[model samples]
Target: MIIPFIIIALISLMIHVMEPVKEIVLDRLNGKITYPKTFIDKEHRTIEFDSLHVYRTLTTSGDFAITGKKIFIKDRKFNYTWTLKSNECLEYWSFMVWYMDKNRPLPLGTAFNEYRLQDFERRKAEGFSKPLFPGTFHTPERTPSQHRQRKEIGGW
Candidate 1:
């Protein structure tokens, strides 16, 4: 009887842990959940996240530069840095969609357009700018500084 109870307990524990894991697997399979792929454009000072349904971009200065199919900056700034929440990015995309087209669906890569330029100009006129430390967003891999320092010490 004790051995049977121990077996049952192990099975119960496994089920409990695997329930969530199974749900996650199903969600991923159904496209209900997605992993984000981040792209950093050091020359443009922009970071982009592509999470299947939604695409987002921000300047190093924390400005919501682009989200989904909308652009928030008329002219790109290379010397800015900041962080933003995913929800904030989604909200910006929704707002731009509503503002641009109420009835039509936003096309892929819709963020690159004259309308975005106009919107960015309007926002700039309203003086909406957030500046943060450039070092706030660092690449996961080795940076130029690391390379430069190592090179200086002849420690390739």
Candidate 2:
């Protein structure tokens, strides 16, 4: 009985700790930026790039609320809207817009940087790399000053 209780407790703790890892995995799997003829979501639903719509609204706190919608063309037509209400929303939205634009490179801070640490670090080092749109998003990585110092010291 005690052994079972201990196992349950450990499982619960592991689940709690794995929450962020699970989210990251889902984001990576679902948020892939591609300009294929058709876009496939994590739910296995498919929609054309031209048919998809991306919208941005202002939140009460003056931040942005980016949302996307698509109309399915199956026997039963339906509308699917997706809103990423997480810290990675900015990056995801950037990728989405870039994909829609056929993968043309957007401005440094306006783009997702394609998971390149150097681009991210350079953006931080330069500082003031604000997004073209207004949003209250944050990437909780190394400090701007630290990155700037690293750049000054010939670090990549």
Candidate 3:
């Protein structure tokens, strides 16, 4: 009886610890899991997604593609197709979750657009124009050390 109780306790402890470990492993593999249901834009503006937009487009090959879009969820480009069939519509969260589960690449164009928009906003905030390019052009005014450090440490 004592042995059974000890096994049960050990199993319970393992179950408790496994969840966090799994999340950590997933975070490392997939980068930080951001809940994009609501997020901030480059201009320090809060972008919220109250509802999802679903649309169907016909490809030149005569196949139909179903796509989903949500404000500030992914990038501004709406070219990522979730399904080839238009039988059912999926909301933003559901589509994103499904895509992640299937280990699909999160829309790269959208991510790139967001990054560009953010950079543009940051430059605007700093009273600059023509965009900052690494190893290409230097700014007239010195950037703060903190900002420079962040630039060096680059992550999405």
Candidate 4:
């Protein structure tokens, strides 16, 4: 019993210590260097975007590609086709959307920061103040009752 308690305590301590390190690593990997018209990724690869496309350096041989598109309002998924490989990619995607659109709310699961807080206020002023987490005040729209009712009514 004492050995089990010690093991659990060690595991908890390790997790507590590693959580911040993981967050720091993620922040660096996902962070970008911004300019007036473009930004650079973690590998110092330049990325530029317009309304329709994200142009980025894709190869070490200096080839560039349209790697992604600007996110539109009401897009709930980070990558609709589940193509992105990691959370770092998702963070980059979220940052791209954040950079491109000033009137939209922060993407879901994004942690609040000073810049994002300011943007949230700006978006709220523009009447796009949806909370990042659903069901904050009440049950979400797709609760079990709603699901059952929709099934009963043969709704999609």
| Clash count per candidate | 7, 0, 1, 0
Report the lDDT tens digits of candidate 2 across residue range 45-153: 4444444456654344335443433222221123545445655665676554443332122334524556546544555455534333333433333447644654455
Runs in model 3 lying further than 4 Å from the true structure: 21-156
The CA lDDT of each predicted structure is 0.34, 0.42, 0.34, 0.37
Q: Using Cα atoms with residue i matched to residue i, what is each candidate's TM-score against the true structure? A: 0.16, 0.28, 0.19, 0.25
Clashing pairs in 3: 75-110
**Over the stretch 32-137, how does candidate 4's per-residue lDDT look in tens digits?**
2222211122322222233123332332333655454332222122221113234366456655455444333334443544355565445445455333323222
Off by over 4 Å in 1: 21-156
Q: How large is the C-alpha RMSD of every model relative to the true structure?
A: 21.4, 13.6, 18.2, 16.8
List candidate 4 segments past 4 Å from native: 1-48, 51-91, 107-111, 115-117, 129-156
The global Cα lDDT (0 to 1) of model 4 is: 0.37
Winner of 1 and 4 under lDDT: 4
Clashing pairs in 1: 60-80, 60-81, 60-82, 61-80, 61-81, 61-82, 62-82
Write one digit per residue (lDDT tens) for candidate 1, span 51-116.
222334544434754433332322122333232244566555444333333112122354645454
Q: What is candidate 2's TM-score against the reference?
A: 0.28
Question: Positional deviation of 78 in candidate 2, in angstroms?
Answer: 2.6
Query: Which scores higher on TM-score, 1 or 2?
Result: 2
Residue pairs clashing in model 4 are none
